[model samples]
Target chain A: MTTSREIRLKSRPVGLPQASNFELATVDLPAPGPDEVQVRNLWMSVDPYMRGRMYDRPSYVPPFQLGQALQGGAVGEVVASNDPDFKPGDIVSSMFGWREYYNASPKALAAGGLGAITKLDTHGIPPQAFLGVVGMPGLTAYVGLLRIAALKDGDVVFVSAAAGAVGSVVCQIAKLKGHTVIGSAGGPEKVAFLKSIGVDHVIDYKATPDVVAELAKVAPKGIDVYFENVGGVHLEAAINSARPFARFALCGMISQYNETGKPEGPPNIIQAVGKSLRLEGFIVSNHVDMFPQFAKDMAEWIKAGKITWKETVEEGVERAPDAFVKLFTGENLGKMLVKLA
Target chain B: MTTSREIRLKSRPVGLPQASNFELATVDLPAPGPDEVQVRNLWMSVDPYMRGRMYDRPSYVPPFQLGQALQGGAVGEVVASNDPDFKPGDIVSSMFGWREYYNASPKALAAGGLGAITKLDTHGIPPQAFLGVVGMPGLTAYVGLLRIAALKDGDVVFVSAAAGAVGSVVCQIAKLKGHTVIGSAGGPEKVAFLKSIGVDHVIDYKATPDVVAELAKVAPKGIDVYFENVGGVHLEAAINSARPFARFALCGMISQYNETGKPEGPPNIIQAVGKSLRLEGFIVSNHVDMFPQFAKDMAEWIKAGKITWKETVEEGVERAPDAFVKLFTGENLGKMLVKLA
Candidate 1:
């Protein structure tokens, strides 16, 4: 029997997720059925949004099925194929969950559209980027910035979680379009990291007490677009810095995700009406048509050495739970990825 | 010397204005300095927006000048004139501040714009209609309801301060456009008034403990457009009932004007982002082009008896301030006007 290491939900945790919230287990890979294929996961992605999945609550998508493997977008190779479309040695991607090996069928991830059995074409680019810079997180930043925020050239942009996967790319893309981009991270190192990647300005919220006053110092003209990756006080600062008719793109609210109780809401919504602002919430799946175009543009930027990124790779599949929990405490330097060996 | 009574701003009041705020003083008439005409005021209009004039703050319009007469649009007759454009005994509307008799010059209220001197036309409509049904209040309601709210033919519309001047016309216009209109007022009397004006639903917020729940019962489709006149709780309830992509026309927030302190803001502004709602603020001056069109439509609606309204006329200029205060307490019905004899 082939052995596979996996991380499973131990118990639904309240507030911040800790070590005891996750449990590691070993399981045998089942023989593939007529239409199923066996996937051997190589690279697994860990994201802040996964914290929402850990809890048993309704969101845009369903919560994690407790005692089941924690699933996420994964890049892997098919070990054996029973389906005619997918053959052995074909590189594929699926929400394969947090496991080293699994028996997956077309019904598991692909239900006819951009299905689970995607042909991973490296096209000479780094493959890990598909999990971060060019995958869901990348598209999240790109689609939200362009469609929802209506980003224009020379417009100023501010992103929360500025050094994180999606936020870092948002800063770079806004910069490529000739807009001034500012980013905020919790500590000094990440702030420096964002600055190194050509971010026009960086503010470590730990050092700045008054976000509105601080943003005024950086973007005296006020923010034209706000890429919201974190919510709460950061949201208030962004809202206050917004000029008339400014657009805000809501991708995620990481700050409120781990809270045990309901967090305080913004009380200055009248400013939105006064400033004639528009704030829109969006999901990456809604804009799938732009992927082919995005892949082309991003590939060119990478070739010209204009685009760069960093990934904090946690070694071993058994340590995946540790890597997932480290994201909450800001231990991640860039896109946090778990490499299965 | 000609005798003309006026309410002069002797001093700015600390809070809710009192008699001490005004000084009724008569001075010798200064003869028309070139291009000036003397007006014998026939009727004056009292409005809620006038409250902004009482404060010393920067707003869309300049605040009332201290130690000077309160300025507003007044309908009167040009009793004496030296300008070639005007003749004696010609009825005109001028921004002739708070006084029974005043002089208008080329450099008057608007200096070089429409407000300098507006000759009243009797297009089979009463001159008083210029202040009520077809004037600033009516125009405000029309512009806000149509341009900002974009009220659809079958859309459900909820207007606050339904018994007030602007809101009364909004409901009539909305009803004529085939909308299921709902309105909120303070008491049963005003509730019945809304029903008389063809509002499909009326909620007496005074009788209901939970306005959001009451609105849910009456407006099953959820409010598509909210014509916000009195803000505060009504605004909160509107936010709760706001349909996805709902439109809010924030014309005024009279409910918070006389508040002892800053009124607590709405609790569910994030719902705006969640539902992709659009809230816009507007003034009638921005939509002056609609006058000739509104003049025709309003006249047609009035002739067909499809639109009806109410006005609480306070006779004598001395009662104008009292009538103005009545609005804050929801005491007056329909448009509030002052008749000078």
Candidate 2:
């Protein structure tokens, strides 16, 4: 028997969840049974989507149950394995997060199963990348750009929240594809980070009094594609700067996720008709079929020094809630993660 | 030297356009020059989109100039022709509407040119059908469903403004393709018309207090495709009733067009991400390449009695402004037209 430290949902949040809404719990773990593998989680992800799960409402994914351990993407080492497919010391990724340890049966690791566990090759890259750039966030950027937006060469692409995990990758990928990339971030630091990754133009939304006018000044020809992560004013600005027939890949509306009341939608959505725009909202899990291709491309890009990543990591499982709360405040530079023992 | 009665835009409208904003004028008809044709318009269409043209804003189509004759889809008889391809007494369609007569040069009739004139065979169908069911509105419905929505068999479709020009055709096509169709229109008369056209379910939005709840009760399985014509609450309700991966073909947003201030956007647009919804806004003129195929399919459908059309036509060009204004108040059924002598 072993004791595992896990984060449990104390209650559903009203708005921006406080640390008190979550409780650190000590859970007793049993020995791995037949066809089961015991994992010691090393790194876990804290994403904006987690905010939606905190609410007891229907979303793309199920809401996090009260008094239960929260689940997310995590990379871990198999400490004990009764299954022949997984051996001790093997690195793997699973959807058993916000906890230090977990036991998964083969059924749980099977294709299309809950808590999908996959053995990681690592390939000299950090295992933590599986939680961000080399994993879900990376695949999201790839599918949203190539499949959803149908991004083409010479297309002027605008990415909101360009300092975030998915947006950063989107910026780099569009630039690599010979498209002019415009990135927007909250502060000068994030804006500078965006420029460091070879973004054509970076808008410090914190300093800009009018984002829409600033976008017009920077992209005079109007953007052909908008990678929407931050909605509200960013969405309105993108719509205003969108050329006729522009495509918008709607991944998230992080800006309004924490609002207690119904957030005001972009008032200029009517411009979509006049501009002949296509705005498609998608969940990353729907495009998992592109994982292999995305992994291959991303790996090559990393090796060629064509892609770079940043991580604002909180040390220890106890800080998971703090790390998650920071995402809403735009405190994280890129992928936000919590390291665990 | 015949005289032509033409409707001119006297001034731009501030809110819902008044009849005073338009004026009727008589102009001398010039004889056909080299490679030209003189047409006496028999029928002209006054559509909702013409309102956008009245505003001096850049859109998919150019805005209507003040103190000049308004242009739209019109079918007429070529009284005289200097071009070999077009002969006298031949029925032709042109974008020279709100007028009793027009002279079109070869430059004006050239492929892809503004005010392009095309010879219409009619094929035993009413000549006025060229302005609605067999023309732009028909193609709008076709492209919106097939190409934009990528509709499949067994897909449940919900059409807003379902008794109107494009929506009526959309409902019929979906039903013909063996898909369940839910239609929403204001008033009992329009609702009855939807049922006559074989719509599986009809919602009289005028009587319904909460359209979203009504849609949920009718389409318990949720809709797979939404043909969006009326926006506002209808759009919000459609999004709420949409199943995962649902497609929305945004043909028009007639509800908010005449609003003096910015129209309120659907507050539930966030549902799009969780449902993986795709909302594509399109203008029919961009997909004119599908005309031949649409015309062929539409002709066959009409011949086999698989399709039917209704027109709420106002007689005389003098009432064209009134006919156009009626669209805002939902005063007409199916295709709204102005019959010219």
Quote the positional error of residue B111 for candidate 1 in Å.
Answer: 8.5
Sorted into a CAPRI-style docking class, model 2 comes out as medium
B279 Cα displacement, candidate 2 (Å): 0.6
lDDT assessment of candidate 2: 0.91
Q: iRMS of every model, one decimal?
A: 3.6, 1.2
Kindly list the per-residue Cα lDDT of model 1 for residues A50-147, writing each as its tens digit: 88777675344578877878888788888888888888887777777589987878755576454366768888766678898888788888898988
TM-score of each: 0.83, 0.98
Q: Best candidate, DockQ-wise?
A: 2
Using TM-score, give the best candidate's number.
Answer: 2
Clashing pairs in model 2, backbone N/Cα/C closer than 3 A: none
Estimate, for each residue in B199-261, the C-alpha lDDT of model 1 and write its tens digit: 999989889999888988899879999998877678888978887668888788786665555
- Please give the TM-score that candidate 1 achieves against the real structure: 0.83
RMSD of 2: 1.5
**In DockQ, how does model 1 score against the reference complex?**
0.29
